[model samples]
Target chain A: MKIALLASTTLDMLPSLADALARAHGLSLEWYVASFGQYEREVLDPASGARQFAPDVVLLSIDADTAARDAKSFRALASQALVSFPTATIFVHNLVLTAPDVLSLLEWNEPESNARMVAQLNLELSGVALGSDRLRVLDLDRVVRSLGIQAVCSPRFSYLGKIPFNKLGLQAIAGQLVTAINAYRGARRKVLVLDLDGTLWGGVLGEDGIEGLRLSNDGEGKAFYDFQQLLLKLWRSGILLTICSKNDEWLGLEAIRTLRFMVLHDEHFAAHRINWEPKATNIAELAEELQLGLDSFVFLDDSAEERALVRAALPEVLTPDLPKDPSEYPTFLMGLNCFETLKLSTEDRGRGALYVQERRRRYEAMGAVSLEEHLESLQTRVRIRAAHPSEFGRVAQLTQRTNQFNTTGIRRTVDELRSLADVDGWQVLVCEASDRFGDYGLVGSALVAQSADGPIVEGFLLSCRVLGRGVEEAFVAATESLVHPGRGVLLRFVSTNRNAVALKKLVELGFVLDEKTGLFGRVAPMELPKWIELETVSL
Target chain B: MPHDNIFPRIQACIVDSLKIEPGRVTQETRQEDLEEWDSIGHLTIVLSVEAEFDASFQMEDIPGMTSVAILTQHVEASGSV
Candidate 1:
């Protein structure tokens, strides 16, 4: 990844610091820091070093005074950068109010003052980010406030090298920019493993016995409640939450179930290993069960010993050090960028509920006498519909997140999904599943592009959550009937590190496989199992 | 020269920032002598020296502040650093 920094101030130390920061976070970014105060010229001119650099990410950084003087210029600069490097992700800085001008307190109170102007600039910049996905405001104002205004800015430094910010402050800005770039590049953690006692709530479940737990609406317990609310927000945004606690399962369940003030319930958790086992083992087991990598798991625990043990054993798993004080937990968790994501989709918002539904089905399946009775009892209904404009985001998410049952292993972006939907003779369908338990949102998608021979399945994938219930076969059957009618639909599967289930599903779906080409085709009417009760819907 | 307290620190800062040999950075060594001391590297050198000496460099002084001797003199003249 190449990163170009175009700033008004002489941030000489930023590039190396940004590279180091990016490298620390497992990103290899080549940095190009333009000369001081070259942002306007570089962005406006096509031959500037920024344009020549052809970076994957461009950081447009300027001080508050410069931005306030010309807010429209900043916006124009961002637009020009986008025009120059169309594919590049531009991160423009939102200016922070530092030293006061001659007006001082009067200016602070005045709406038309420099301070207000900067605030308006930031507000408009935020609107830009909201409107366009390619552009983002780095929120350097927040970064400066975090580092403290008096500490980050120095009059001597500002006059001396045209360097407006403190050394560490520049480093912090670069680090944050690197993080934003990485997030834009689609590097994100998928799962968060939380410890119950001391981490989620303020007491041990066994000793507290659900009643004695310190979870409350106010006081020290409020911190734990606040943290749970934050975790719930993250979970709702598609971050899978699992528990790895060293406590009795029944007691943990009791605490989760009985606590009135608890923000997270048992249903909120995707999986749990609430037993007296090493948390490392439990985390590994959870990772396996969820079919996610250890690198994608962030284990948050209040216990230093537990954090250290997981950090030592599974070094890939992120174990953020818990703050010494419980009150700081919410703020601490909020600051961790491990769970940052570029976009949120319908699949993401409904992820936790879908997992909960899966867990319920699993529990029911465990109790049933046989597999047939368990699946039959599920009363699963898969609704296949044409990909709507509202569904493109979830369709893209399914392509990115679903690995096990993803045919062709092709990850499509939201734009790609939208364009594919519009292509001539192409059909993109989203599979929505609901049963006696719950609605599994948009669980799968199939992308088929028409060719001379027939309609070729460019990509097809079903969420592993709905795998065993014959959703994949039903989807294939529906696709064949919709696309080819009487002729065979050409199915293609590309084997990936985690897509064996896709290949297996293709085989089971009656697609004759060519081992050499990894292509599957069915010339005959799709013969799906009678058990798969699928209903087709309109666009 | 040995008595001047800032010379060794300046030399160290130069060597560290430019990734050049310690001996390569002497009183006679210009910014052009080191391959890494391009325009971008010059800014890095000035900032690094400023950070090392706890002194700030004026924009007017930046062009002449390229060499080690000039940098050392600038820092020493600032006095407080």
Candidate 2:
């Protein structure tokens, strides 16, 4: 990530903050910190450091004093940022009042206090950014309040070099800024694998029985109930929930089925592995069933032993500590930044329904004698066509979230996807899958461009729910038929930590890897598997 | 606190906070002698020493306290650690 730091005050604390943020997000940050008082000249000039830096993200930090002095100029900076770099996303920090007591005393009997004026200035700045897609307002006031205003600022540093924030304060700002960047770029975690017993409810299901379990009604049960309600809200907003519990399957089922006060039932969870096996094992199996990366999971268990074991075995899974008291669990879980996203697409809203459909398909596969017979029974149909204007948001979302089966793992925003769709030769094909179980809405997408050599595939990905049913081969064959005859298909396979399944599938389908470019390609007469009945149509 | 024992602990805090070499941050090291020990670095070292010793200093005393020997003396003079 390339970031250009533009601040009215000294930028002495950003490097340390950037180091911590970079390490946490598994990203490298190449930063360019411009000299103080250069925000205007650097942004306005055509050949200034802002343009020459060409950063992916630009962070503008200005103090409350400057904002109060000229509110119009403060809000104008966001527009200037957008006009300067049309593609780059700019993060402007909202003003934090350094000396509220003095401001309150000086602005007495006025319509609004100086602090209120600064608040209004921040609101107006946010209003400006709200009208533009490439600009965002970062709440420095929230950062100040959360980290404590006194601890975040140092009088000595401010007096010495006009540095506004201390080390911890700068770190808090960097943390929030990186989260905003992740939300913008679509690198958010997807699944929440919650534990049972002390995690979900107040007591053990086997010991307490269905009627005896404390859930959501009285005293201590209200906390558990509230947490369940929170999880349901996440579920409704498109977060997949699963269970990994060490208990009798029937007992767990009885608790979920008979607990009338529980907000979530057996049907709410996408999958559950309830047995005596280690939670680490069950979590891995749940990831396989859901076809999500371990990095995308957050494991919540009340047992310190269980949390430690999972942390040791699967370091990628985020295991947040739970206080011994059940009352604090809800607030603790709400504070986690594990599951954060800027926008929710249609596919996200329908994700729980799609998982339910997959469960039915799994049951159907269990009874079938052979793999071919199982697929034949499902009556699967994959519709390959150009991405429509209505599905642009979902297409962009799929590019961001579909990591396990993504070939290149290249994420695109809605505007970028729309521009690509408008191009003459670029065809963004969205795959809609349906079967006997149900309709899995917008399960796959591929971006292909007509090159001189042939049609070069920029990206190809399928949802895990639609995989294992010959959808991969069917989608590929449909894509091959879309291209002009006698022209070969060039496939690009960019390896990531979690896309091995995609790479393996491509290699199995006779796509040979080019040693030089590290991309996969196959020529004409690419064979399509007989089991798949594929169809292609123009949008 | 004994004045003799404060030198190594202050040196450790300086080395750790500034990310400087361990043995090189001796009692003789001054703010002007090192490149990273600029205005901000000086503040960081002072704040870090305050935090490490659980002490506080006035804003006026910070600019004068630059060297390891002088900073250690200032921290001891705060008398709270």
Candidate 3:
């Protein structure tokens, strides 16, 4: 990753800390740190080194004093950064007051104290980057609040090198910077597979009945109650919740639903396996049923033995140690940066509700006379169209999340898709599907382009929620009409371990693979099922 | 606290911070002896020593305390360690 650092203060000591943090997360950062007082020439001039470097990310850090004195100029420079680094994801540091004491004395909207100026300027910077996917706040204020204000600044270092952060402060800022970088790379865990016994409440549910579990609105139970509150926030933010416990299914579900102080219920979890089976086995079953990879799971259990078993059985799953005390659970869970996601669409906010709708679909499936009859009865429709700038977020999200039914496992950020939209013969296709149950909003995307050999299907993927209803066949057939049709339409497949089902669908659609060339070719568009009504537009 | 035994402990901290070998440093080692312990690394060494010994040095005393022998004396003077 290329990171260009621009700061009003000297950043001589920051790169070593930042580089070490990046390396720990398997990222090698190529950094360009500009000299002092050259922000104008470095960003605006065409021939400057920063402009030529064309970074993947830009970090702008300005101290509280400099920002307070020239708030207007810094805000203008931040706005220009969007135009300057057209494709780069820009990060602007929010100013922080150096001293913690006297913070309560400052009045709102008053610029007399440096604390008030810093707070007002930070709010304005947020206003500038509102609703923008490329521009983001690095949030230095949050870091300073966590570490005490005095811990972040050193007068000796500031005098010697104009650097604002001390050693501890540099470590904290570097850790947060890497979190933003990992978020940009789409390296986020999707599912929180939690264990129940002593984790959710104080006592084991089997040993102590649901009435005896220490979960209430106050006292020792307040610790567990507060822990559930944070987990509820994660559920609302689109993290899939699941249960893997060693208890009776009926009893566990009773405690989760009937308790007065319980913040989560059966509807919040996408799925669960509350049986006496080993947790690792149950987690693998959940992964298979959800059609998600094991790498996207985070397992939390109070028992050290359960955590150790999951870690040994599935090395891909992230199992962090749980503190012996449950009161520290909320703080520990909040400190984890694995749940970071950049953009949340409508589909994200209603994800848990969508799973509830899926249960209804499953019940409807069981009542049908046959598999073919059930699919046709659902009334599935597939719509493929030219992707607009607004739908790019959903399209990029599908590329990052889909694993099993993908033709080519390619990941593209929203910024990458924006740059690709300008090419003459390239098509970014948004595939939205729906049935009688509910709407699956923008579930798939395909990358098709008019190459010298003709239109080639470069990338294709769909959400597992919309899998079994001839959607993949409909998507491939629709791509044929997208490019010039006279030449033979071609598709490429690179086999991944999870994508064997994709190859079966391709062969079923009459695409024959040439052994010598390793390319799948079809002279005409394949036939779609009568149940699939494809809506397409020619480029 | 006995001040005589703290020199080797301070030397270990400096070697660990600079990622250097321990054999090259004695009680008399200074900043000029190693290429990695330049001006910027001087700050790293000072921070490591402060953290290791639980002492705080004022700005004026940092530049003059360039050797393990001098740093041990400063660590004694800060008196918190």
**What are the clashing pairs of model 1?**
A160-B57
The residue pairs in collision within model 2 are none
How should the candidates be ordered by lDDT, best one leading?
Answer: 3, 2, 1
Give one digit per residue, the lDDT tens place, for model 1 in A227-338: 8888889999989999989998888888788888988887789999999989999999998887777888999898999999999999989999999888898788768876
Top TM-score hit: 3
How many angstroms is the interface RMSD of candidate 2?
2.5
List candidate 1 segments past 4 Å from native.
A2-6, A10-13, A30-56, A75-88, A154-157, A208-212, A389-391, A408-412, A415-428, A449-455, A512-518, A535-539, B1-28, B35-40, B50-64, B69-81
Question: Interface root mean square deviation for model 1, in Å?
Answer: 3.6
lDDT agreement of model 2 with the native = 0.80
> Candidate 3 local accuracy as lDDT?
0.82
Q: Ten consecutive residues with minimal summed lDDT in candidate 1 chain A?
A: A523-532
User: Model 1 over residues B25-79: C-alpha lDDT tens digits?
Assistant: 8877788788888765676677667777677667677777878778877887877
Query: DockQ winner among the candidates?
Result: 2
lDDT of 3 at A205: 86
Best by lDDT: 3
Per-residue lDDT tens digits for candidate 3, residues A1-539, read: 89899888866556767778788789899989887777667877878788899999999888888877888877787888888999899999888877443536554534576666777788889987785878898889889889987777777867765767677887798889889898888888988988876788899788888888888898998888898888888888888899999999999898888877988887788889999899999999988877789999999999999999999999999999989999999889878899987667778877776776776788788999999899999899989877888888878887787888788888788888887777545688888888877888888888776677777777878888888789987887777676655555677898888888888877877888988867788766566888887888765
List lDDT for all candidates, in order.
Answer: 0.79, 0.80, 0.82
Instruction: Let me know the TM-score candidate 2 reaches against the reference structure.
Output: 0.85
Fnat computed for model 2: 0.29
